[model samples]
Target: MTDLAVTLLLFFALVSTAIAIALLRSLFAVVMLSGVFSLLAALLFIAMDAVDVAFTEAAVGAGISSVLMLGTIALTARHEMKPKRWSATPLIIVGIIGAFLIYGTLDMPAFGDPNAPVQTYLNPDFIARTPKEIDVPNIVTAVLASYRGFDTMGEVAVVFVAGLGVTMLIGGSGGFLRRRYRETVLSRKDGQA
Candidate 1:
C-alpha cells in the first residue's frame, strides 16, 4: 500500500511537471522543469525497483541533458517565440499514436506477475548462469557487460550519436562559432558607435 501510494504520487508529479513544461514559454524554466521531470521519472523508476534505470535517468536526463539545454539556451533564446498559428495536425497525430500505444499495452501481462515469461524463464536462467558463464562477482555487472553487451553498446552508440547531433546543431565547431558570434556582435557595436 505504501509503495503504491509513493508510486502514484511520483506519477502525479511527473504528469504535472510535463504539463508545466508544455505550457511554459520561458526556455530557462522549461529546461529546469525538464530536469525536475527527469528527477521525478528517476524517482518513479526507483519506486519500481529499477535502480540502474533511475541512475541513468538522473545522470543523463536530469544532469547532462539539463546542462546541454542550458548551454543551447545560452547560445539561443531565453524565451520561446510565439507561434504564428496553431495547428491541429500534430495534436491529432499525437493522439492517434498515444491511442495505439495504450491499446498495445492492454495485452501486456500485469506488472510483477510471478508467472510472467521473463520472471519464470529469463530471471532463473540469468541467475543460474551468472556465476558459471560470466564469472563476474556482481550479477548485474555481468549481465549488463557480458550477457547484454551488444544492447548496452547500442545504447551507448545512440547516446554518442545524439550528443554529436546536438553539437552539430548548436554549432559544427562549437568554440569557433562562439568566437564568430562574439566578433559579429562586437563589429555591430563598433559600426553603431
Candidate 2:
C-alpha cells in the first residue's frame, strides 16, 4: 500500500510536469515547470532510497538549470504571441504514452522486498567489500565520490559546458551599450573639432 502510494505520487508529479511543459505558452513558465518536475523527481528518488541521486537532482536539475534558463530568457523576448487554439493530437499522443507507462508499472517488483532479485544479488558483494577493499563506513559515498570519481568529474564538466554555452548564447552583457558609448565619443569629438 505504501509503495503504491509513493509510486502514484511520482507518476502524478511526472505527468503534471509533462502536461505543464506541453501546455504552457511562455518559455519562463516552461522553465519553472521543469524545476517543479526536477523537485518531484528528487522526492521520488528519495522515496526509493536513493539519497545521493536525489541530492544531485535537487541541486543541479532544479536549482542550477532553472537559474541558467531564467538568465537565458532575460536576454530573449519577454512575451510570446498568444495562439488562438491548441491542437488535440499532441494531447492524445501524450495520453497514450501515459497509459503505456502505467501498464508497464504493473510488472514492477514491490518496494523493499528482502527476497527481491536486486537485493539478493547485491547483498553478498555489499557485505564482502565494505570491510576489506572499500574501507568506508558509508558505502554510497565511497562508491560515488571515490570509486566513480571520474564519472562524477565528467558530469560536472558537462554541466560547466552547458553553463558556458548558455552564457555565450544569451549575450546580455552590454554589447549595445558599448556600441552606443563609442558612438557618443565619436559625436563629442566631431562637435569639438
Candidate 3:
C-alpha cells in the first residue's frame, strides 16, 4: 500500500485504540491498549523515517511504560470505580486547547517542503560538516547527539526527572503509594458487599 494509505490506516487504528482506552473500565486492558497505541505510533514514526523517535517510542512508551503501569496495577486496583456523573468541562477545555494548537500550526510549512527553514539551512549544514567534524558513520546519531545535543540533553533531563519522581512516589519510605495501595484493597473488599 501507498504511504498515505498506510498513514490513514494507522490513524484510524490510533483513534480506535484511544476510544477503547477511554471507554474501558479495566486498568489492565487500558494499559495493554496503550502499549498497542504506542507501538502503532512507533510504526508511524518509522514510516516517516524517524527511526530514533520510533525506537524511543517502542522502548519507552510501549515497553517501559506498559511494564510500569502493570506494576502499578499489581500494587493498586485492577478496575476503576464507576463515576456517578460525566462532566463536559474537561472536554470543552481540551477542545479549546486543541483548536488553538491547530490554529498555531496553520502557518508551519508542509511536511517535506523544500522551502522550509530546516530543509534550506540546518540539513545542508549538517550534511556538509558532519562527515569531517563529527566523523560519525550514522548521520542521525551525529545530528541528534552533536548538532542537536542541547535539545537531546533537555529531553534526557525531563525523562530523568520524571523517573525520579515516580521512584520517590512509589519506592521511598513514608510514600503515599502505600496508603493508596491499602485504600485500594479496602475499597475492593467493601465493593464485595
Candidate 4:
C-alpha cells in the first residue's frame, strides 16, 4: 500500500528527470539527470522490497555507470551538436512497448500480499534454511557467490569478450596508436641523421 505509493512517486520522479534531460541541450545536465534517474530506480527497487536488486542497482547503475559517463564527458564536448530533424519512429516504438509493460502491471498482485505466489513459495524456505546451510550471515551474498557462481562467471566472461571486441574494433590499426608508431619511426630515422 504505502510502498506502492512511494515506488510510484519515485518512478514518476525518475521519468520526469529523464524527460527533462532529453529536452535539455547540456550534456552535463543530461548526465546528471541520468545519475538521478538511476538513483531513483535504486530507491524504487528498495521500496518494492527487492533489497538484493536495489543493492546492485545502487552500486552498478547509480555509482559505476554514472562515473563512466562523467569520464566520457571529460573527454568530449559539454554541448551536443543540434540535430537537423528529430526522428519519431524509435520514440513511437518505445512508447508502445512502455505502454504494454505498464498494462502488464495492472494484472500483478498488490505489494506484500501474503497469498501471492511469490511470497508463498520461495521466501519462507530461504528465510528458514539460509542460516543453517550457510554458516556465515548475509544470505544474498551467499546465494550469489555460492549458488549462482556459474552465472556470475558467465557474465564476467561475456563482459570480458565484449571489451576485447570493442578494443579490436576501435583500437586496432587506427586512431592514436597508428599515429604514434609513425611518429616514433620518423623520430628514430631523424636521430640517425
Candidate 5:
C-alpha cells in the first residue's frame, strides 16, 4: 500500500514536471524541470526495485545531461522565440501516437505473472548459474557487467561521446563565436572612430 502511494506520488510529480517543461518558455527553467523529471523517474525506478536503473538515471539523466543542457543554453537562446501562431496539428499527432502506444501495451502480460517467459526460463537460469558462474554475490551487477559487457561498453562509449560533444560545443565553436563577436564589435568601433 505504501509503495503504491509512493508510486502514485512520483508518477504525478513526473507528469507535473513534464507539463511545466512544456508550458515554460525559458530554457533555464525547462532544463531545471527536466532535472526534476529525471529525479522523479529515478525515484520511481527505486520504488520498482530497480536500483541500477535508478542510479543510472540519477547520474546520467539528472547529473550530466542537466549540465550539458545548461551549457547549451549558455551557448544559445535563453528564451524560446514566441511563436506567431500555435497549431493543434502537432498536439493531435502526438495524441494519436500516444494512443497507439497505449494500445500496443494492451497485449503485454500482466506484471508478476508466474507464467511469463522471463519467470519460466531466463530468470531461473540466471538464478541458478549466477552464483557458480560469475561468483558475484549480487546477480544484477554480475549480469550487467559480465553478461552484458558489450552492451555496457556501448553505453559507456555513448556517454563519453555525449560528454565530449558537449565539451567541444562549449569550448570549441562557442568560444570562437564569442571571441569573434567581441573582436568584430571592437573593430567596428575603431573603424567608426
Candidate 6:
C-alpha cells in the first residue's frame, strides 16, 4: 500500500512536470523543468527497486542532457517563437499513436506476476547458471555484462550516435567550423601577401 502510494505520487509529479514543460515558452525554464522531470522519473524507478536504471536516468537524463540543452540554448534563442496559428494535425496524430500504445499494453501480463514468461522461464535458468557459467558473484552484474552484452552495446551505440549527431548539429553549417576555416584562410592570405 505504501509502495503504491509512493509510485502514484511520483507519477503525479512527473505528469505535472511534463505539463509545465509543454506550456513554458522560455527555453531555459523548459530545460530546467525537463531536468526536474528526469529526476522525478529516477525517483519513480527507485520506487520500483530499479536502482541502476534510476542512476542512469539521473546522470544522463538530468545531468548531461540538461547541460547539453543549456549549451544549445546559450547558442540559440532563450524564448520560443509564437506559433502563427494553432494546428490540430499534430494533436490528432499524437492521440492516434497514444491509443495504439495503450492498446498494445492491454495484452501484457500484470506487473510482477510470478507466472510471467520471464519469471517462469528465464529467472530460474539465470539463477542456476550464474555461478556455474559466468562465475560472477553478483547475478545482476553477470546478467548485464554477459547475458545482455549485445543489448548493452546497442544502448551505448545509440547514446554515442545521439551525442555525435548533437555535436554535428551544433558545429555544422555557419558555426564553429566555419569560423575556424575563415580564420585559417585569412591567416594564410596575410602570410602570402
Best-fitting candidate, scored by lDDT: 3
Return whichever of 4 and 5 wins on lDDT.
5
lDDT of 4 by residue, 50-130 (tens): 788988888888888889788888977898889889899989999999999999999999866899988788768876777
lDDT of 5 by residue, 32-122 (tens): 9999899999999999888989999999999989997998899778999888999999999999999999999998888769898767977
Candidate 1 vs candidate 4, TM-score winner: 1
Candidate 2, residues 1-193: lDDT per residue as tens digits?
Answer: 8987998979898998888797777898899999999999999999888888899999999998899789878978655778878789977998999999999989878867788788788666876787688788877877667667899899999989987875565445655676688899999999999
What's the TM-score of each model vs. the native?
0.80, 0.65, 0.81, 0.75, 0.82, 0.81
| Model 4: lDDT to the true structure | 0.83
Using TM-score as the measure, the top candidate is 5
TM-score of model 1 vs. true structure: 0.80
Candidate 5 deviant stretches above 4 angstroms = 160-193
Report how far residue 2 has shifted in candidate 4, in Å.
Answer: 3.7
Q: How accurate is candidate 6 locally (lDDT)?
A: 0.92
lDDT value, residue 147 of candidate 1: 90
> On lDDT, who's better, 1 or 4?
1
Order the candidates by lDDT, highest first — what do you get? Answer: 3, 6, 1, 5, 2, 4
Residue pairs of candidate 5 with colliding backbone atoms: none
Ranked by TM-score, top first: 5, 6, 3, 1, 4, 2
- Model 1 has a clash total of 0
Could you give candidate 1's per-residue lDDT for residues 101-149 as a string of tens digits? 9999998889889998878978889989999999987687889999999
Candidate 6 lands at a TM-score of 0.81
Worst 10 residues of 4 by lDDT: 166-175
Find the 10 residues in a row with the least total lDDT in model 3. Answer: 169-178
> Which residue pairs show collisions in model 3?
none
- Model 4 scores a TM of 0.75
